[model samples]
Target: MGIITGVIGHWGWEVEDYLLDVWEAHRTPIILATSSILICVWLYLYFSEEREGLVALPRQYTVETKRTSPFQLSNPLPTTKPKVVGEKATTVGPKRIRGEIPRQTTQKESPKRDGLEIQVLVFYSSLTGKTEKAVKDLVEVSQEEINGAGTGTCRFPDAQILDLSEIDYDEYFINPPKREDGKAVDYFYLLLLPSYNIDTINDTFLEHLKETHNDFRIDSAPLSNLVGYSVFGFGDREGWPTEEDGYGFQAKEVDRWMAKLTGRKRAFPLGLGDLKMDGKARLLEWSSGLIDVLRMFAQTGVLGDGVRGSGDADESDGEYASDEEEDTETSIEGNEKPTKNKGSIDDVEDLGKMVAPSEKAPLAIDFTTYGKSKPVNIQTPQAKEMVPKTSPTYAALTKQGYSIIGSHSGVKICRWTKSALRGRGSCYKYSFYGINSHQCMESTPSLSCSNKCVFCWRHGTNPVGTIWRWQVDPPDLIFSGIKEAHYKKIKMMRGVPGVRAERFQEAMRIRHCALSLVGEPIFYPHINEFVGMLHAERISTFLVCNAQHPDQLAALKPITQLYVSIDAADKESLRRIDRPLHRDFWERFQRCLEILREKRFKQRTVFRLTLVKGFNIDEAVKGYADLVDKALPCFVEIKGVTYCGTSTSSSAGLTMANVPFYAEIQEFVEALNHELNSRGLEYGIAAEHAHSCCALLASARFKKNGKWHTRIDYDRFFDLWEERGPDGDWTPEDYMGEETPEWATWGNGGFDPRDTRVDRKGRKIEV
Candidate 1:
């Protein structure tokens, strides 16, 4: 250490002494220099970064001119503007202007909206093109109206249509994208989302919006800078069940979700376009209403309902919008049942408000409204081939011509219903079970059956499934829709000659509901609840099962009557007769029979044998008796299969020869009775309906002291059900033993050929 100090002293001549002397001599100058540098740095930071919230950088900028790519081109710089002495030259690239503010940095100052160039965003999802076309029609009609009116203030009408399927669900769910300019672009919005089937929202494109909104769910305040939106549903009311929310369920759900997300008021009421009716007219009407609403919003800076504040946040300057919306239900038959004293469709056009009190009744729909005379093009996809009841094509038909009761149930005017309406003849059911043919609402709770019967008249166009593939509609809506559709058919028959108004009115009351429509009725998840609903209305429910869903049958509530379709007596015949989906269909069939036997004492059980002569008639007496013993139903309806004009199903190959004659059906019934009697089971032929080629075999138990009690006393059964309620354990004995009405018994009232009817030889008048 001494040697190093000596070497330093030799070079600097006492360095420690020199440093001490210098500090004492220039201490003030050194301290002033340090203070000046610190002051200069603070001034630079305060001037550059203090005012705006944007990021700031130092005044001296670094420029990198090197290029990494070999293909980089070298270009001469453009001639620069002459600069005055001491003027700063601007460095251009992606840098922001120093002190300039953009015109659209906030919601209140959007230049596009202020310039009267209003645009709406329309998003839709549709398996069929009906919903998409409905949206387009609205936009097109709105544009034409805007141009025609020439209201310069709200002049330009531009709607940005987008498919929900095209959106990035994951990206939007994490963080909704915003405009690059940091402005809240104000615009009106519409959604035309249809439910995939009766009970689900799978196919609707708005599902992404739902997912994104749910991810960032907020309860305290509305979404930042969101605007009001309107909802439109495109669906067939008949396609959905009343017990379910029907076709409008999906649209309602979307509207509710959006309302919660934005905390914004609805621009207009929910615009519903029926899939089966005149959607173009409905779309046009909705668009016209929307224009009025938009005009009101533009002129007064408020909606007819209420006003929203101009600020970006949710807090409003005026009162929060009133929920004065009316509750209305639209059925397939253009039936609108208003649950409240609210405005009609015409009221909106006059008052420029969606909500108002009115006493106008629902107008009768003109068939001409569905004519091709209207220039408006409502695009519906035409199937290249015949559609099954389960196919999207058949589903689309509900939106076209077929009367859908609810999401799953459908009501079509049957051949028998038509015959009865024309005063020709009633259905075999009427003769067999006392069902009023004209007053019967023929529908199934489910369109998708588990078994695709070879003799199915639907041609397998409807959906089929081992389990329920659709959602269950609400019971209330299904009941209402069913009655509406049934009555609509009766109303159409009002113009026909010989149709009694009293009978038509009684038909409107809907005394009987036949769940024997094309599909399997038991597949509906809420079958029991639906039965209760029918009973509540004093309507008789005769639910027919395909004997595939034993569990569903077992859990079923007692209705007015229950019919199990015994298509075949043996397993092989069963497979050939009813193309079942289940591998263990035989076991399932046996189980269903066991359930029927168990439920026989609680409900009127009938084994419906559809006698296809050439198929299962060979050695079928003993086989049928065994099945009868297993079920032990109160009655058996042995009916000959009527040949409806055939198509794509196996039954299509059948000719008139396939349809057994009335005598053949009677022979089968007698043989079945003999087989049952031989086994000490008292089964005897009770009555016959010759016109329908059907016969009823009643249990000897139903005949007390030679008085027959085969027919159901529906009112008494309803009373018993009501007294017992859903959880009751009452038996059939509680309400049974009533003598069959003479008029309802098969032989007492048969189809009279004397009435003028449309037959193979055109109109025939019988004397």
Candidate 2:
């Protein structure tokens, strides 16, 4: 027990001695408290300094201990690098933090490096000029920030601004320049994109970016070859906070895309300005912040300082605030005035004057109330009359081998007409009319026709119109003009061996006028008068109408023959074949036939069916017979297509397939004959012109005692026509029965199609 006590006392003495030694130290509490306070102060200062320079880097990476490459960070000073015209700029050699001072290099400065300044390029796309104005303001403000002596070592002394829409993509991006050291240097890009529809990316800028970068990924990517760029968008706030509704989404979208493409080191935070508010002020604010970013990049070569906080000065335009106040005051005044007007006695007195006025013009009268036609409004005449040019029409006609006559008429020497001139033969019309083809003057009063027939022999170059708005030539002038033009054409054939001088002289007499030249001859408003003039000159007239203008046809005066061109048998076929300008063309065609039916007995009414092969030929025999029964005309002419080459007017791309062979035409004609016979129409093939690929169908009415009286007695017709004058009465039966002379009959009359090697007179040339 004594020994334990002695040990315990010894431990206690050692503890007391240690406590006495601690207490003997001088100012121990004061020293400890001072040290603690100093440490806390140092920590606060260090952390606060760190926060000022902290940057929000991309989420993909964090800062590490390793040094950064030169391209990633700039040192305190860099020897100015010269720009070689065609060389590339050098990239970073090592990756390091901006705080890490790089080893300085000593080298002789190249002459090209002298006066070289860092460049900033601004591209903007704007529709309402707001963004454009903002861009101008930015340039004006940034000039001071990036340039001047106060910019220190980070100043960009030069900048170029361009409309994003106008830049050449290749010269800027594809062919980027290089420094003399064979390294590619990148310039900073400031893009101000104005969204077209609030949320939609600016198409002009997007397209420009797409065209410049072939493989720039907007969504996901391994970002390589990053080019430092910043973007902002100008938009309006119409809808917000919905899945597809927002303002400045385009700005966010572009910012995201740039990050994915070039990484956050090269992309800056999106800047947005609402165009609906103080857009100019917001834009200036964004620019001011962006300038700091540019300075950081120029000085440190790293994106260090984060997005600028709103502590910066408000550069908002004071004029805008004043304007808003004025607008508010104006609105209040406008409201107060309306309220006063409602209560004022003076306003009530003028209530009648405030009532809306009637729409009727002063002194207006309605003539229609008295059952009179509405008076035509006489507008002031045009300063210059529109004298329609016949030249372009004439040129197109001539290019397709037509001869022009007078201003509106045209003449073409048909092969048959030429054949007859050389004594070879005449056209089938000659056989049907007892007229000489060579003496038949083919002319028209109007060259424009509205119908675009698929098998048109004129190759569809004939100009078309609904009305006669053209300068007209008097019938006398046309008669004389046609004679002169025909003779001139005949004179050109003088040296040709087969052209008979006697036949040519006879051709000049002009005994017959076929107004079937290349147009709807009946479209001429003066057609009836023209017919009277033709009969006056003792010229037998054969006028061909497209059957489109019925009123014109119904008003026609009697001629030796009045023919309607039938291109298709049914309504569908008619639409497909004729391509008529009138939408109600089928109805118009029916009305035309009704007119023809009424006039069938007045004139030698004929239906000239221009049969196209593989088109209106199959099963069309029935359709043709139905039409034949409708009008019960004196004759029906079926002619095979002579395939004219590609027509200026759509021809359904007619080829040889559209053209029927001679045998096919004969088969179709025979089928048509059987159909007509079965219908008890008593129509029979009168004759067929083999060389012409045409057949004639004569109605039983024209068969006098089983003999066809198809030929017109030209002299008797002229006598009747002249005797009756323009207002005279006449019928086809008046001159229907002159025996068709053998030479003017179909089989023996015109030139043969099989004998195409005929001379100019249509006589088969013996080899």
Candidate 1: C-alpha RMSD to true structure equals 26.3
lDDT of 1 at 614: 76
Off by over 4 Å in 1: 1-392, 395-401, 650-653, 737-749, 752-767
lDDT (tens digit, per residue) of candidate 2 on 301-374: 43331111101111111211222211010101011211112221120011122223462113222212212223
The CA root-mean-square deviation of candidate 2, after full C-alpha superposition on the true structure, stands at 31.4
Q: Provide the overall lDDT of each model, using Cα atoms, as 2-decimal numbers.
A: 0.59, 0.58
TM of each candidate vs. truth: 0.48, 0.48
Measured with C-alpha atoms, the lDDT of residue 532 in candidate 2 is 74
lDDT of 1 by residue, 1-767 (tens): 99998897787866777887999999999899999999999998865653443223334422333211111112113132222223333333442211211111012222233434345678787767777787777677677654443244444356678777776644332223454786434445677787655333343434654654555333212332333466766667676643134656677666655554444345554555566775566666656656655665455443322212221111111222323321111122222221222342211011112212352223222122111223222123431122234544343444333576555777755556655654566766665556767788777767666676766755444556564434456777877787776655554443232332234445656788888876788876677888888888888888888897777788887787789999999999998878777777888899889999888877788998998867877679889999999889988988888654343333335556778877677677777888899998987777667767777889877877776676666777787778878558876656564666554454553444323334432344342
Q: Which ranges of candidate 2 are over 4 A from the true structure?
A: 1-391, 399-401, 457-459, 647-651, 726-729, 741-767
lDDT of 1: 0.59
* Top-scoring candidate (TM-score): 1
